[model samples]
Target chain A: MMAVRSTFGRTGNHPDILAGLVFIVVGALGLWAGRDLRVGAAAMMGPGYLPLIISSLIVFIGLIVTIMGLVRDNERLDVIRLRPLLIILVAVAGFAYAAESLGFILAAIWLIGVGSMADRETRLREVAASIVVLTTFGILVFIVGLGVQMKLGPF
Target chain B: MEFLDSLILGFSTAATPTNLLFCLMGALLGTLIGVLPGIGPTATLAILLPITFFLPPLAALIMLAGIFYGAQYGGSTTAILVNLPGEASSVVTAIDGYQMAKQGRAGAALAVAALGSFFAGTVSTLGLAIAGPALATLALSFGPAEYFSLTIFGLLCATVLASGSVIKAIAMICIGLLLGMVGTDVNSGSERLTFGATELFDGVEFVVIAVGLFGIAEIIVNLETPELRGLIAAKISRLWPTRDDFRRAWPAVLRGTGLGTFLGILPGGGATLSAFSAYTLEKKVSRDPRRFGKGAIEGVAGPEAANNAGAQSSFIPLLTLGIPSNAVMAMLLGAMTIHGITPGPAVIQNQPELFWGLVASMWIGNAMLLVINLPLIGLWVRLLTVPYRLLYPAILLFCCVGVYSVSNRAFDVALAVGFGFLGYLFRKAKCEPGPLLLGFVLGPLLETNLRRALLISQGDPSVFIQRPISLALLVAALGLLVLMVVPAVRKTREEAFVDEES
Candidate 1:
């Protein structure tokens, strides 16, 4: 495992390689997902015509990009700090689930409270104050003023 | 006489109390975000887009247009005072504007930028008023083949002109086209790529993709980097430029305005590209280029005018031809779709008020920006001191609420989370998300036109080449592709984007 990791790190452009792999996977998935749909001629295109064409083009581009990545000058990927990445997503995901069931107050709190932790410099007092202030502001502006159709509480 | 009558109708419609108030709100909000770094006009517009659904169509457009040009005005404020460009379009403004500030001419730089921008805004708005009907008249004659060819030209030009690796941008556009095909096919009524999710039958909401890619992804990226804050460099002793400064800046402003108006009408050309190009032009044309980085008034004046003109004129393509030039125009197109307005040649003939009202509001918004930016510079400077830690949480709340409010579906918000993660991946891969958006908005239109054209031609592909307009557009797209392959033009393209990368 260690030898494999070192070899991967020493290889050509990591970002391009990753990007190419992603494109190939997504294109293949698109082709697989649309296998059931029909593809008529250009005059009368079936549901899968454009999707299949686009998927094949994507895969073709991905192949070229991957080849270029292998032959081009070496460039390392940027340092991936997963802490903020994961925390922000989790905060947003939590808000999505809680918004309808738990109501705006809890959802807004979950969003701001957890989302604030993504930053290393976040102070507890600052987070607490922001949650209170922003929640009230969101309620007034989004719900009351703009009529965004969100319930204020679980009731 | 007809043009004058239309202008009068526009002024009457835009000068209503409600439209005027929304215009002021947009300009004020625009300047606020423009003064603060880290947030961009695209993300702000995305966040605010859902809220506009509650508004009347003309009022909403008026406000959004205000925010777009108002940002250009406010960005130069921070670029001059603190040596930090609050928006990408103001990067060149900071080079000499900051030097002027350090030389105790901050007030002069600020005044010239605001006045020059106001002038450019007026000219571009007039250009819009004059060019709108003529373009619409020409567009009325287009058939399906012409539409398909135009979309192809627009997409190709967008990829070529956008600052990034062309192949990567093209790949991103393909991904966007695939995503746009996910919902039920209108022709056959069968889902293409829903992955077994039923909520996606109606298709992915534009707001969800926008807020996810621009808003949520932006916040995450901002968190990864440490913040840099610059202190205000000098005191404002004077608020007006001297006679000599005016003499030097007027010609540059005139040149910048002309260039910006023309460039902004092109696919993927807007404030940032226009500003960079204007700066290059000024440097090339100057007798003594050494004075550029050393507090030349023309340096501050030229790009400032160009960016404002570019920001305003970019609306022309969307309004007349129903084709968006960039990401922000894509958002506007999305907004128009939500309002049940199909933006095409018919818009001017059928709903004359909407087009003219928006044009009038842009000029009014520019005048408001001058008043908001000049005397209130100190207030905006103070706003720059607000830290990202305190700011991002509010923005995050807006993102969550904004996504949720779109159709009031938890599923959409959840989908946005997925796009947010994908956006993070794309950023790591050095792929721009802007072209993806442009492709997504145009995909359904492209597909519909292609089918119609082929159906008429009985599967014969020669119809595309047979139509004069369609053939010309395809030839232009092919020419652009060939230019990219040439080593000299490729080198120049790479050099043009170097400032953006840095």
Candidate 2:
């Protein structure tokens, strides 16, 4: 048992600890946000009735998980690579803002162009070609054929 | 006689020109994506959910069903040839299938897998047609108290069957329930957790959550991990399996079909669980278990059949009870809601055409997959060379546009970005997102029924214990909870999942 304990890394169950923290934070947030809503009796449930119960249950589970994490053998978390995560998110967020205002063409180009950069091996020529092709397809299929409400351009 | 007439009506509805065309398109597209690694059927369905709005309800459902079962067939193709299981359900097939390929028996393995899957699909489709009406009729007699207890049972069973820490899965379900309460309450007519967002007054769209979590998060994870591409090393010698191989495969196929059909009906049980269980059963019952993982034909045949059968039968619960068993079924539920078709016991009585039409189309779709997978094997293998760098941009574009199309507003898309980030965090925490989805879909039903039951009983919690069915369901749920606490059962459960990882 001692030998097995040494095999684990310095950090103690990082994944479980992180998971517990997330549950606690989300549960607390739910409680804070819905605090104003009435928690009526079981006979007449208000909007906050189930929400409050579920939120409290979440917090309870979080406490158990956190406690377990402290007692269990140690295990390190996976290395977090922020490059792809951030790049993909920014690309999607940009498209969300651009899709309605700037229209499908620009949004498609921005999405594909910037989205391609999430990978390190992406090339300039491929990105440009994808933007051209995907934009044309989006215009023809989504805009013309499917009758999506978005405009072709900002004009 | 009535069953025959209903089936005939089903065939007539499914055999229509437009439905046939859509069904064929769905099968081909399902095969295309299923053969590709990094894209599963759930994400594919989520991305394409909005596009189906352009199609009629029956046509759309037929196409989606086609994609699902067609994926089972296509997944086995790559598993046999390239040692890469395109779908999670096919992971077990790669064990002996790749070995068969190395022994220059790739064609036999591929043929056996396709044929066995087709057989299993037919049987499960028949099972769905028979069980759907009977189960729906039984459900019609249920009251609010019964439904509340049933939902509790279903939710608890889902956490148990799912591969993870049961407590964590339950917590995720609670989080999902909390998220479901974000919109205006139906009873009180007051916003609960909108946080002053006007767009959220109507509630968060299911498509937004699905696309953000399954679609966007999956891509980011895929990018973070290095790609593993296996080369197809063996030549195809013959397309037909030997008589001895057929004899060995048939009994396994029969056993697999029976097991898959039963498992698929359970909560949180689908192709992945069914296939894993069937493989384990086959290994246990084999006369010489050492042949497994060393070109054993039964190894490929059993799991291939089980996954296909399980995929088809999982639709039974959703079609009959309006309760989705897995994430894919949840997507189907969302699709049904979008088309203004409420899936429940009334669906069979009121919209008989729709229910029967979907059942019949599944059979047609399975037949189409057999034809598509066998002859077009080379085409799908060629597609494996299409690098993720080129593919992901297209997927990212589709996901963005799909979410925007749901409400024709960018707000939903923006909201999905937040979910995408949260989904990434959940992945880092090693939490499975599947239970969260099931919880979100069932939360409203659970709360509504619980409120009604309590209201009728004048706040008496004993109403749950008073009803016979409700008492039985709650007791079963309690039993499952107790079983999970037993140290021996917990160890075996852990061991069962550990087998899949290796």
Candidate 3:
């Protein structure tokens, strides 16, 4: 069903192709993972029954989508921008790791400082102000007011 | 007589000073966040949901409800002033609203949007009071078969209506259903997808997924587009709509309210679809269709009213059938569960005060929004001038602290980061997260009920078709699938989303 198979060498890649491939792979993985689970009868469905049905459907849908991409005119895939993507993800992961060890205020300040670097122009003064205000607000609203259990300082 | 008595009881419960304060607080926070670009109602609701855990359930629910409709009202403010749709539902509003701003009618457009939203909010609150209990009564008759069928219809509609390739949307839903099954199987006591991790026992937290997909992914996307956003520099000519503008707006508001109220009650339909459909209807009804997008007062008035009304009435399915029509409603459902309150047909009977109080507070909250939005227009416009560089960092920090505080688990935060990455990938692939969220919420319910229905029929697959209601729902789902696959209808759906995308 590769309608565009003749033109494949000429046309650039389309996002729909990649998306379809992802779905098919994910569906196949899900089916394989649940291979051992019993499907059970209609009157008594096992845990695998719905999963099996859904994964198969997912694969079917994925194939249809892949065909649609082949037959229909599609938008070309945009180059992935890794700079901001990495900065934002790594910054958040850093917070997840640091928030517990360094306490709320330090973790938050560290998060802001690193996250601010993702932007083209970084303003230190604004980042500093945001840190002070957000920390006070977080402490006031979350810690003291809501009584969410978090350490105030590493001290 | 019974309705009036219940109304009186509701007023007494909601009119208390504390609830009024929480309502005001929610409205204020909702407007503030709604005015800010990049943070939509879904993100704001998810970020604020954990905080509701500490408050009394009634007050917590009242505040959350206030935030929802309040955000709808405030979303139009940014759309009109800066040509930025602060929320997805307001995307249609930005079309004509920004044109009005360029024509030096910004004040008129903003005023009309606010007035139309307040009117729609009032009418829909009335609708909730009148129709909510009746729907609950209707839902009381639903068996496991009916529930399974209803969820099937909801998931299918959600997949179809989502703004992307229908196949991709269905795939997302299937993936969501799979992700939702990660925890232990309630009936069999075996984990479905969990790979023997202790954290997998309870399944993944809804908050973790919500924050990651909406909050974190949004920040990542916004980071890539670092262009300076300029505010519309049009002078404030008049602070209110002219007489002629009022004449054009009132009828549109009425039509919008009717459209929104009707669609909002449907399982998969809500504010975003209502706004789009309302704009399309307004264009169809207009004698001069060319004026529809170029600063037509009806364009601003209709979609704003429709969005707010749809937002309010979306609660019908949530409170009555315990089915969330959208992501924000799902978060609210999660909040209610945390408070040990199961929202369903019995909720009205078992928690009358909580039910009626939420209803009463909605009306009060609408009044508060009218007061807060009009006078604070200038302040919000100034908020648009704030640099995104500073603002996004604060948003990310709050997201981190919020997710961590959910269970004080670092593991959850890590999990949230992972979802955020996946969310970004989905966005790149043009797959929508909305159907995924809806499917995830409805997954367990669908599974549990399908099993139960089969159990009752001794595993006969025909059990779903034998019952009238179940059969009707399944037929509707099938019909929707057929409609979605039809070439003409698929083209129209794609065109609608494409118009909004540009």
Candidate 4:
């Protein structure tokens, strides 16, 4: 069973070490560029000076991360689960496309039906029931009640 | 007498049926969204922000303010009942609220929160009603440098708000500042950091970044869970605080109102600091300090109260001085600008009804929230259980339509999509979406103001120091910067800092 706590850990990767390494390299480049970019102002403050200062601050912060990552911090490797994620992405894309095509009610019905079906155990009949119930209520509330505009179809 | 006249006028405007309805809708919607985790008010406000384009400025401000604190109230419910915080300020609430729930005292916890928040809001709003005109005068005396320094002050306090780690928070703040630097330079009319795209000229849209980060990114993250939202099935009880709960909560509410009201006027660190400070103060004053992380009612009462109070107070800087304290306020200011209502000391004098009406409506909106939320808790809980897969497509559709409706630009919708993916990347890279949203909202204002101020000063830097208000703000910002590097402040949360390494 995937616990709620564990479910959130996939937000990022092998914790500090790898993240630190990336920040370290990026900061180093920023620092190098800042050193070159720091031209002294003659008439007014050089435009690059403020940014150079900011860039150097980034470098120092990155260096701190680099050192911290080296000295024995336990970081876990997180793996992404792709299947459901892909399905969600596709469902969202489909909803975007069909939203104007099928009209809000029909489009919403199909979107809810198909999106919920991403779970293997979800039955077509159950999804259909949910879709019919929700979309009908949505049309009543949003279109009829609230006067929200929805283009149902191209025709 | 003049103030009185203005107050009466404002009440007239606020009393309009359309404005009242908007206020009620804002509060009701705020409570609904606030109770649900993963839907922060920033995104919701951004998505709805365009509605103000067609509304009078007072109504727009009234509604946005309702949503802000209303969300604060709503988040407390989830914190108490579900052990999940819908927004950052509620993190402190969850510390004791969840404990209260586990111990079968969630009813008392929520009741205490509601009552305390109500008291705090009332007291602080009165505070605003009294002090706002004076502050508006002080703000009227301000020059460009003063306003500029105030903006710097808002940015500087991100240090105090550096949630987990000071170092990482600083890094993020700097990154936010850099991101704010994107789009065109108002001074030169030269584009910066757009990679030369025409869309780059306007800079990033708040709707795009906010929706991408908070809405779409939340959906993507939720997709990984493969379960519905609100996994916990907390049992709720009566909606009244016991005498003992009231006795314990009253002092906390008072302290929270004071702290929140004061901090809220400071510009940047208002609501966030008020919540954290209230939590700490409660723990310090608690008869049993250890009960803090457990289900202590004071913990829930104080922070919730302070958070709401702080939210109410934050508007002072924006309304009086025309200097926004945070991203949401910046958006409100933008809404005002879109309506051609320039907020300043003059606003109160010229449009007394708009100002006073808004103040009166805050009182009204808070009352509405307490009434709507308490009995309707079960309704929100039911809404929370709506499975993510089934619910998300609807949200996505609304988001697209909402984006398109405001801009009527297909490019805006497309931009939203790109930002959505980037939002996911930022999440995976350990960045908080809040500051990024802040950057996008404040960028145009910061750039425009900086240029205008400089143009007035003829490119002189000393103008910031010469102006008293600006000087004070600069001093505050300087103080914050120094404290960020202080060992005492930095040492206490080394673990929190380490977590921000990414």
Candidate 5:
């Protein structure tokens, strides 16, 4: 317990409690979602049956985690960092949206350009160089070599 | 005699120019990604899985297998040079390995790691050749009750070995099982949780989850840390280790190989646990334990050997019983399924060429890695200086293309992006995703076996306890659970992981 406390001692919040609560909420949500499925008997189990059992088990474990959280004062939750997380997510999302309509070259260019923003040291010239190199590689590897039937350019 | 014949046949198959070329490509690619920060084998395999569609099945399987073990070799190189483990299995390598680099013995450390890994890989390959067919015969006798029990044991053991919070690991496994239950029910042919989408009918693609969680989530986590941190740029001294260093490392390498081979054969025991346990064992057995964290060559040799051996031996369960011991094996199993080959006892009988060839290629791949890595160490070090800003975007683009290529569906790409966010959230919540992945891969099999066992027994759950093998497995699982609950043992486990975390 002291080890747990020391590990989480930095933030002074009850991370275990938060983690426990998150698990519980997720479990409950899963159970609620799986409720419509039929829970057949053990002899001939239905698809919903295992979900109901597993989700409840998760909730039980979550309860134990919550109890541990309350009894022990331990490490606090880390402050969430939005910059890197957001930039990466947005970059991937942009590529996903653009790749179909915009073609591989443009989609890849957009990805490198925006993803470079995640690092403060990133320069326009570096991003441009990366874009040129990666797009060509992607074309040769994915299309020419692997024979993936994707558009070569946005024509 | 049969083993020798098959091995010869395997060598013949694997030595073909096409197979050798594929193996080389896989090893090179595996090392490339493994040396790069933020891209592990799991992500690389997932992103590259689509390429298998274009290759012959045997070549594809051989290549994928090469990537799996080759990554272990590269992961150790990074651990030695950069103090950052390229994969989870190399976490302990970073401890003594980085210290060695700092002490200007980086070249020695890298050589020891590669040589140790090579030795382990060769030994494990031999073990696989001898033991794989025997284990497959043993698996031929397993019934549904036994299979279900085996999965239970595997899941429980994984939970026990998981880094933090047993309850959380169990929760993750449950969540994984739930997610796996998505799509139409195979039995009744009715949709279970598809929510009326046609894509949902096929269920979630494993590639999407793999890329999102391992690939995309890693990028986000890495990005949170400072982009330009201090790396211990030790001068590359002589590439070869001294006689004294060799003498010290060989024994640890042999011992670690032995330990790892044994552990790798067990369900839920794989490279990561073997490496950690090997390190602990070395610390215990060493005459001067204090020298361990201060650049002991034994530390690098033992864990590197153990992880590589463990990585190879982990293939045992997958080939013999058609059960994956870890995420990488799970991905391989998925790939095999896509190629219309169901992995199980029948594989030895049905696909001897593929099986023996893959086993033989592993040895060849091991040799290839030893040759490929030592000469390329300087190149990999150069790769380390490539800015994460540029590296990550290329990875992201590849991930996008990879997912898109799977079905020519933008939906899967979108799905990967969504899971990437969830994966980041899970990491923040202090949940380890390993058990979740194991559960996800094994979920359907677990469910199938569970239902089958019950159906056979007419609703009697006692069948699990009635069968001797099943009973034994469950008892062992129960004992493991009890051990986890025992405060003292739990503390020791936590300490072991904590030591690695530092």
Candidate 6:
């Protein structure tokens, strides 16, 4: 699974290594947490028992997945693209925050417009036109017909 | 005759102006989304589910079912014309299909696929009509123990269906089940895995995961691979298969129908598998196997037919047993439950009209798909010609609006975004989302039945073994696992799994 990298003077195994380590550690933590529940009398299987079993299974699976990933050398996990992902992430968070104040229709209109504009290819005119047409339809369908009363922004 | 009479009532219900209109509309939309890469039936249905809130349950279901199977037809259109299979089932279509397109026979490939799917749709609906009641009647006697064992069997079969590595597939499923456990524990009313987030209390919504993973992740992957942008083949004329093409394809159709009918019955891995199996089966049975992947008409026709039939027949098991055979079917089942239909053995008996009405509508939708797609092959090809960068943004917008309209919860939209990342990870990990979805949707039911079975047997684990039918099913499950693992069978298994890579 060792793939040759042209640069960095070292194998960039950080991604898989970190993920594998996380799984193994999380599995251990789960096992420790789940170990104490009562096994129950005659026929009752304790909830903790299942968690225990499941945690162990996860640990085993995670270990295998991690090692296999390392061995396969099938992919190269690029450093996290902070710039674009950050914009999309913030926009989605904005979408949630807007849902209440602006209401479903208005918030959605903004969400679509803003989200699309984040990408360079989107045009302002197209976004504005789409906002009008689609929002009008959304308001009629969800608010008027379905009776969901999610608030729109300050009147 | 009684079956015939109820079927007549079904026609009466389905043939109504609104129902037929919705059926046609459903097929139209289904094809549209299917033709577009990255948009599958589950996300499309989830987005449109809110619209159903305004309709009668029957009409809502008819429309939703149309979206589900209708997408299957649309899926192949793109897979053939473009190198991309819009969904897993259509992957087989892309094999010989893209070959044909490359060789200037794009028209023939499109004709063969659309026709083969139409043929399967007709036959499988007939299969559903004749076999559903019989299956339901048989299912009437399943005790809690049997169902619990059957659920286990279903989970086990998922490993058999997974590609690359079966172990990873099962591991993903285990993770899926654990994730499913994040919400409230219904029976005990205990907080199990919430870890305090209010969002976790409600558990992860299926739509969020489906949309994010399938819809959003596809975008990221597409962005990564520049080689996979648009339909690379040149333009073609009228939608007609040649005489030689027809002669080669007819047998493939029959073979595909057989594969589709049975695999479609297996939950979670139907259309994708059916199509591929149809291709490989045609190849193995062919007089010249070398022609298999090299623009062979039989290769394209068989899998397309089988995949379509498999998509259609998958409904039989789910409708009869309340067991979701796959993610899309599970989503449909979820939609059904939201409409207050308890989908189990009694669904057929309690709602015969609803059940048969849906069956009849499949025929209608299939017919509509053929009409819409064949004459409009050029139209769909033109649609593929649209730059994906432009096309994908509109779909993303649809997803936003669709989610917002449904619950009117921005939180849901955020969930979709989060899932998009998760879907990316899944793609990176090389796990098929279908089986994971099966695990998620079926988790609660499987848990409930396992608990009930335990209660019924008073904790006797032998109940599963004691019942002959359950024993048979469990044995079959073990056999399936063995078949999947045997070294001698490994080559055959890969071929089957490849067909489903759609």
What is the lDDT of every predicted structure here?
0.91, 0.90, 0.84, 0.68, 0.84, 0.73
Fraction of the native A-B contacts that model 1 recovers: 0.80
Q: Tens-digit lDDT track for model 1 on B145-244?
A: 9999999999999899889888888988998888899889999999879988999998889999999999999999888878989988989999999999
| Tens-digit per-residue lDDT, A7-118, candidate 6 | 4324434345444544566566556644544444325555554556666887897787677666655455543433334445555667677776766655666656665654
By DockQ, who's the top model here? Answer: 1
Candidate 3 residue pairs that clash: A42-B459, A43-B459
lDDT of candidate model 2 versus the reference = 0.90
Q: Second chain of candidate 1: TM-score?
A: 0.99
Put down candidate 5 lDDT per residue, B1-502, tens digits, no spaces: 8878998889999999999999999998888877876777887787777768778998998899888888898888888888878788898998899998998899999999999999999999899988999988988899999999988898887778657888788888888888898898898777766666788788888778888888889888887766543475587878899999999999999999999998888766778888999999999999999999889999999999999999999999899888887778878887887788888889998889888999999999999999999987888877877767777777777788888888887778888988898788788778877777878888999999999999999999999999999999999999999998899999898887885543
| Model 1 ranges off by over 4 Å | A1-7
Residue B347 local lDDT, model 4: 85
What does each candidate score in C-alpha RMSD? 2.0, 3.0, 3.5, 5.4, 3.5, 3.8
Provide the lowest-lDDT 10-residue window in model 3 chain B.
Answer: B224-233
TM-score of chain B of each: 0.99, 0.99, 0.97, 0.88, 0.96, 0.91
Docking class of 6: acceptable
**Relative to the unseen true structure, what is the C-alpha lDDT of residue B195 in candidate 2, on a scale of 0 to 100?**
95
What are the per-model DockQ values? 0.80, 0.76, 0.62, 0.21, 0.57, 0.33
| lDDT score, candidate 4, position B231 | 49
TM-scores of chain A across the candidates, in order, are: 0.93, 0.90, 0.79, 0.54, 0.82, 0.66
Model 5 stretches astray by more than 4 angstroms: A1-14, A152-155, B99-104, B228-233
User: In model 1, what is the error at residue B494, expressed in angstroms?
Assistant: 1.2
What lDDT, from 0 to 1, does candidate 3 have?
0.84
Question: Interface root-mean-square deviation for each candidate?
Answer: 0.8, 0.8, 1.6, 5.5, 1.7, 3.8
Top lDDT hit: 1
**How many clashes in each candidate?**
0, 0, 2, 4, 1, 12
List the candidate 4 regions with Cα displacement exceeding 4 Å. A1-79, A83-155, B51-54, B98-106, B165-196, B199-201, B226-239, B268-272, B290-295, B337-346, B452-463, B466-468, B493-502
Write the residue-wise lDDT of candidate 2 on A20-139 in tens digits. 989999999999989999999999888888889999999999988988886788876666777888899999999999987898888888899889998888999999999998889988
